[model samples]
Target: MSGKSSWPELVGVMATAAATQIGHDRPDVAVEVLPPGAPLTPDYNDHRVRVFINLSAVVIQTPVIG
Candidate 1:
């Protein structure tokens, strides 16, 4: 799935988790492999080049404070 979301943080966190599950095991190495001080989160449309993981999003909203 090609995932994009209004919540880039959610995407980033999930991406980080996915990486960790697969043994990348470091947040920095998970998101971007280019160098230090790269973007803290991937773009909404960005799937990792090496891994070819497509993250097509399906958002369902619920009130957080309801």
Candidate 2:
């Protein structure tokens, strides 16, 4: 959990793989796979990483710890 805080390379990866990779890197945080434009609270969390995906279940944005 002391490595990268963001995964820009995972943008085009599959959601499941992205989640698994993120989880392995930051087991202390929660990884949430969500579709783009999904409703999300404005509050930022240090223990959370949101993986935004497209309709094909492919990550559309860089997964980052907020």
Candidate 3:
């Protein structure tokens, strides 16, 4: 990922990956994940600015398999 990328883009990437994983097991299932909030300080590195966005995206995109 590039530094100029937006938070939403990062989130979308994660979502896509999660969706792919879900599709692997349940091809008929559809996943719709959403971000909770901005990324926290610990979620991103010091060189990143939109860490909150990325973090939030990751949280939202994470799959909950049971």
The whole-model C-alpha lDDT of candidate 2 against the native structure comes to 0.91
TM-score of model 3 vs. true structure: 0.37
Higher TM-score: candidate 1 or 2?
2
**What is the C-alpha lDDT profile of model 1 across 24-65, one tens digit per residue?**
322222232222233434344233322222343211221010
Give lDDT tens digits, candidate 3, residues 1-66: 222222333334555564555455454443444445533334433332322214435533323322
Question: Order of candidates by lDDT, top first?
Answer: 2, 3, 1
The parts of candidate 2 lying over 4 Å away from their true place are none
Best by TM-score: 2
Q: What's the ranking of the predictions by TM-score, best on top?
A: 2, 3, 1
Could you tell me how far off, in angstroms, the CA of residue 54 lies in candidate 2 after the best superposition?
A: 0.3
Which residue pairs clash in candidate 2? 45-66
- Report the candidate with higher lDDT, 1 versus 3: 3
Candidate 2, TM-score vs. the true structure? 0.92
Candidate 2, residues 2-49, lDDT tens digits: the string is: 777999999999999999999988899999899867899999999999
Top lDDT hit: 2
